[model samples]
Target: MVSYGLEEKTALMTSLTDKLASTENSLIESTGRLDRIKEAFHRSEARYHSLEEMERNLEGYQEGVKSILLSKGGDTSPLAGIHGIVADFLDIITPAPNIPNRDNIEGELQAEKVIEAVLGERLQNIVVEGQEDTKKAIEFLKSNCAGRTTFIPKRPRPEKYRIEGKALQQLSNISGVIGPAMTFIEFREGYEALAEYFFSDVVIVDKLETALNLLKETNSSYTFVTIDGEVVESSGRITGGISNGKSPGLIQKRRELRALKNELLRLEREVSGTEGEVERAKNEKVLLQVQIENINKQIHEETIRIVNIDKDIEALIDDEKRIQLRIETLCLEERGIDSEISNLSSELNIYNEEIQRLLAEQAEGEQEIQGLIESQKLGRERWEEAQRGITTRKLELATRKEKRESLSVRLKELGERIESATTLTTDKEESLSKIDQKIDGYLREKSGIESTITDLWQKKDAISKEIVAKENERAGREERQRLSEEELKEKRRVMEDIKKEINQFEIQKAEIRLETGHLKETIYTTYQINLEEEIKNLNLKDLNIDELTSSLTALKERLNRMGPVNLASIEEYQELNQRYEFLTSQESDLTQACETLHKTISKINMTTREMFLNTFNIINEKFQYLFQLFFQGGESKLVLTDENNVLDSGIEIFAQPPGKKVSQLALLSGGEKALTAISLIFATFLARPTPFCVLDEIDAPLDEVNTERFINSVKDMTGFSQFIIITHNKRTMEA
Candidate 1:
C-alpha cells in the first residue's frame, strides 16, 4: 500500500508537471498564431491605406490635368504677322545653312563695277570748237602729240561765266594741250573728262604744267611766271607811263627802252646761262616725277585690286545664287518636316487627352477600391481582436480544468484514507493503543484536511463558474471573429473585382488612346496644323492673361491705397527738385566763393581790426582826459568782449567825481548812460566807421551837462563817416 501510495504520488506529480509543460507549449503556440494573424492584418491594413491614398492623389492629379487642358484654346487661329516676323528672325539668326554669308560684300562690289562700266561705255564723247588758226594750232598739236593724246572740252570756272562761259579768266586761264609744240596757241583740254564728265564735283585738269608752259609762250613781255598758283615777280619789270614833250623825257624814254632792250639781251644771255638751272630743275622734276610715278603706281595697284575685287564679287554673287537655290531646296524639305511635325504634335495631343481621361476613370475606380480596402482593414482589425479574445478564453478554460483535476485528486485521497484506517484498527489493537495520540493528531489532521478539501471544492466551483463564463465569451468572440473574417473576405473579393474592372478600363483606355492617336494623326495630316504647339501656346497665353489680371488687380489696389496723384504737384515737385539742384549747385559755388571771400575779408579784417585797436587805444586815452574834465579824475580803456568782436565790444568811459572811491559807468545817471553810450559809439565809430551809421535820438535821455560832452565826441567822430542823426536838439544836430 505504501509503495502504491508512493507510486500514485509520483504519478500525480509527473502528471501535473506534464500538464504544466503541455499548457506552456499550447500557450506558446496560440500566442504565436495570434501574433502572426495580427502581423498579417497590419500588412493588409497598410496596403489598403496606401491604395486609398494613391486613389485620392490620382483623383486630384486627374482634375488638375483636365483643368490644364481646358485652359488652353483649341487650334483655330493663324499666327500674327509680328509673330511670323519673330519666327523668321529666330530662324534667320540661328546658326543655320540658309543665312546669307559675309562674302556678300564682294557680290555687291561686283554689281557696282558692272553698273559703272555700263554707264561709262554709254557716255564717252568728243568735241572741237575753233576756226582756222585754232584748227592749224590743233593740227600742229595733234601731229606733235603722235597719237599720245586726245582733246577734251574744258569746264568753265565761276569767274569764267563773266567771260561768256569761256574756260579762261584774266587772272587764271585753263585749257588742255596734248602736244610738244611749246606754243600757247595749241592748247586744249584732255579726253578723260568726257568719259567721266558728269560724275565729278570739280573738273580736274593738268592746270599747273599747262599754266607754266602758257606763261613761257605768251606774247606779254612782262614774263610773268606762275608755279602752283603762286607768282614771284622781279622788281620794276612793268613799263610805267612817261612824261611827254621834253627832250630830256624823250631821251630818257629812249634810254629806258634801250635799257629795257639791254635787259632783254641780258635775259637772253641769262636764258642760255639758265641751262644749268634748267638741268637742276630737270633733276628736281625727275625726283618729283618719280614720286608722282610711285603714286600713280599705287593708284594703278589699287585699281587692279579693285578689278580683282570685282572678279571675286562676281564669284561670290554666283555662290549666293547657288546658296539661294539650296535654301529653296531646304525650305521644301523643311515644309515636309513641318507637316510631319504638325501631324505628330496633333497625335501627341490626342494621346495626352486620352491619357487624362483614362487617369480620371482609373482614379474613380481606384477610389472605390480604396474605400473597400479601408472597410476590409476595419474588418480585419475586428477579426484580430475577436481572435485574441478567443485565445484568452481558451487559456482560461485550460487553467480552470487544471485546478479542477487537482481538487478531485485531493478529495479521492481523503476518502481512501478514511476507509483504510477503519479496517486496520482491530488487528493492531496494542499498536493502535500506542498510536491513539497519533490517531487523535491524525483526526485533527483529517479535520484540517477535510476543511481544506471543502475550501478547494468551493474554489473549484467558482473556477467552474468562471470557466462557463469564459466559454460563453470565447464562443461569442469566435462568432464575431468568423463574421469579421467573412466580411474581410467579401471586401477583398470586391476589391479584386474592382481591380479586374480597372484592368479592363485600362485596356479600354489603351484602345481609345490608340484610336485617338490614329484619328489625330489622320486629322493633322489632312489639316497640316500643329495642334500640340497651338495648345502649348494657348496654355502660355492663358497663364500670361491670368498673371496679367492678377498684376493689374494688385496695381489697382496699390493705386487706390495711394489715392489721387496731383499732376500739378508732381510737376511742381519736379520743378522744385530742379530748382533745389540748381540752388545746391549754386550753394556749392557760393561756398567756394565764400571761402575765397572769407580769406580775403579775414585778412582785411585782421589788418583793420588791429589798426582800429591801436587807434581806439589812442582815442580812449584822449577821451578819458575829456571825461576826467567832467568828473575831475577817471581812467578809461577800450576792450573787446567776443571772439569775433564785430559787435560785442565797445568803448568804456569811466569817471569818478571828486572825493569818490570808485569810478563805474553803472553808477551814473540816465543822462550819463545816454551821454556815455553816445560817446562810446562815437569813439568806436572813429575806430572803424565803414560806410555809414545812423543815430536815432542819441541825446533824448541826456541832460545839458552830459549832452555837451556827447556833442563834442560826435564832432570829433565827423572825420570817419557820413552820419545821419535824428535828434530833437538843434545844438546836437548842428554839431
Candidate 2:
C-alpha cells in the first residue's frame, strides 16, 4: 500500500510541474506581445513631441511675418492697401481711461466712435468719410460703397452767414460739436493735408439753428454740418444721414493675426488629444505588465507550495519506517508466545492475555490511519488553492489581451485625427489661394457695373424732370377750362357759331392727336416711363380746341427736330448689376479672410504674452528659493527687466551671499559663486527634475568643506534621481 501511494504522489507532482512549465511558456509569449505593443505605443508617442517642435517653428514664422507686416512698407499688398500708419489722436493726447463696460472684445475700434470723438456726432451717414465709401453718394439715403470714394465734391459757400468765428465758441456749449475739421489738434499736425483734401471747408455745429447761423456767418467760406453729421453744403444742398461702422483697414491686420492664432490653437488641441491616446496605450501596457507580474508571483507561490508538499511527503515516509520497525518487534513477540504455549498447556490462559495485548496494538494502527487521512486533506486544500490562483491569473491575462486590442483602436483613432488635421490645413490654404487669384477678375466686373449704373441713373433723372414739367402744364390747362366753360355758357347764341368753328377745329385736333400719339410712342420706346399717365389721370375740358391743335402742331414739329434717345442702357445696367453682386460677395468673403488673418496674429501675440508671464513667474519663484539655499542665509530674487510686457523683456537675477560685506553678487568670493550656482541648480532640480543631470567641474572652485557639502546634498537626492558630478577635487570625488 505504501509503495502504491508513493508512486501516485510522484505522478501528481510530475503533472503539476509540467502544468507550471506550460504556464510559464504562455506568460513569456504574452510578455513578448506586450513588449511589441509598448514599443509601438512609444513610437506613436514620439509624434506628439514632433508636433510640439512643429508648433514652435510655426510660432517663429508667425512672429517674423508679424514683424514684417508691422514694419512700414513691409506689406505692399495692393489688395489690402496698407499704405501708412494711422494713429488715433485721442489715444495719444487724452488716452481713454479704462472702462470695464467699454471693453472692445474683438479689439476693433468702430469708425462711429472715432468720428464722434474727432469730427462730431455719428448718427446716420457721417462716420469717418476717408474710410472707403461708407455709402453710395448718388443713392444718398440708402448705402452702397463698391468703389473707393475719396472726397465730396466742392460746393459754393453760404452767401449770408450769421455766426462768426468767435460766436462758435458760445455755441460750443451744446453737447456734441467739435469745431471745424481744421480745429482738431491732430489736424494741425501731419494730417493737415488729409484734412484739407476731405474736410477743409466743412464746419460742425451742435444745433440746427447753430448750423444755419454758421452757414449764414460762413457765407465767408465754410459749409455747415449738424452734430448728428447732417451736412449743409455751401451751395445749400444737404447730404448725410447714414452711419458707417469701423473702417476695414483699422481692424484687418489684427483680425488676420487672431485668425492664425485660432488655427494654431486648434492644431495644438489636436496634438494634445493624440498625446492622450499615446498615454492611454502606455497605461494599457503598464496594466498588462502588472498582471504579468501578479501571474509570476502566483507561479512562485505555487513552487513554494510544491516544495512544502514534498517535505510533508518525506516526513510521512519517515513516520511509516518507524511504524514498520514497531510492527516487526510485535510479530517477534507473538512468535515467542506461540512457542511457550506449545511447551506448557497450563500457560494457555497467558496466551489469551497476549491476544488481548495484540488487539490493543491494532487500535494504535487505526490512529495512524486517521493521521494519514488528515495529511491527505491538507494536500488537497493546497492543490485547490493553487487551482483558484491559476484560474484568476488566466482571467487577468485575458483582460490584458482585451486592453491591447483597445489600444490598437485608439492608435487608429489618433491616426485619423492627424490625417484630418493635415487635410483641413491643405484645403484652407488652397481656398485662400483661389480667392487671391480670382480677385482681379472681380475688380473688373465691379468697374463695369459702376459705369452702367451711372448711365442708368442719368436717364432716370432726365425722365423725372420731363414728368414734372408736363404736370405743371396740365394744371394750367385745367384752370383755363373752368374759366372757358363759364364764358361759353353765358354766350349761348354765339355758341352755334363757336360750335361750327369747334367742329372745323376738331378735324385739325384729330390730326394733332395722331401726331402727339406718335411722339409719345417714340418717347416710350426710348424711356420706359412717360407723361401720358399723368395726363390721363387729369380731367381736361376741350374748350380751346383750335388753339390746342395749333400748339400740338408746334410740339410735333419740335419732336421731329429732336434726335432719337437710346433705350439699351437699362437692360445693360441690370445684367451688370447681377454680375456686380456676385463679385461683391466674393470680395466680401476676401475681406472676411483678411480680417481673420489679422485677428489670428493679435491672438498669438496675446497668448505669447500670457504664456511668457506664467513661465517667468514659476522660474522666478524657483530661482529665489534656490538663491537663498545656495547662500546658506542671504536673500535673492528674480525680476523681469520690463514689468509692463513679459514678451518684450528679459529676466534679471539679484542675489546676496551669506556674510557678504557688500550687497551685490559682484562682491562674492570664488567659493561663494560656486555655492550660489549649485544652490540655484539644486533648486531648479527640485522644481523640475530631469531623468539625468550632469555637472562638469562644478566643484572646482569649492574648498574641501563646501565640496563635501555639495557631494552630500547630491547623495541625499539620489534615491529619486541620478546625478553625475565631474570634479578634480579629491573630497568631491571621494564623496
Off by over 4 Å in 1: 1-44, 47-49, 52-432, 526-735
**Candidate 1 local accuracy as lDDT?**
0.45
Off by over 4 Å in 2: 1-263, 344-735
- Cα lDDT tens digits, model 2, 1-735, are 323433343344444434433444444344334434433433333334334443333322222222323321223332133222222211222233232323322233233333344333211112122333222222321122121222221222333334446765644443334455444324324444444544555555554566666567646456666545466767767666564753222222233344445555665565456545544554555554565445445444544554565565566556555545654554565455445434433333444454455445445434544564656654766556655754655565565456546655754665565566556556655654555444444444444434443543464465457547655754575456446534533453364476578678967975886677568655654554576575777567745778889999999899888755465688678658756965796697689658757866777888788877776667667767666644557777667888887677876656776665565566777887677677767766755555469889999988776776687668544423457777788887665
Global Cα RMSD, each model:
66.4, 43.4
Q: What is the Cα-based TM-score of model 1?
A: 0.19
lDDT of 1 by residue, 137-237 (tens): 34443322211212223331222111112322332333442111111111123422232332221111123344345445543222222211122112323
lDDT by candidate, in order shown: 0.45, 0.51
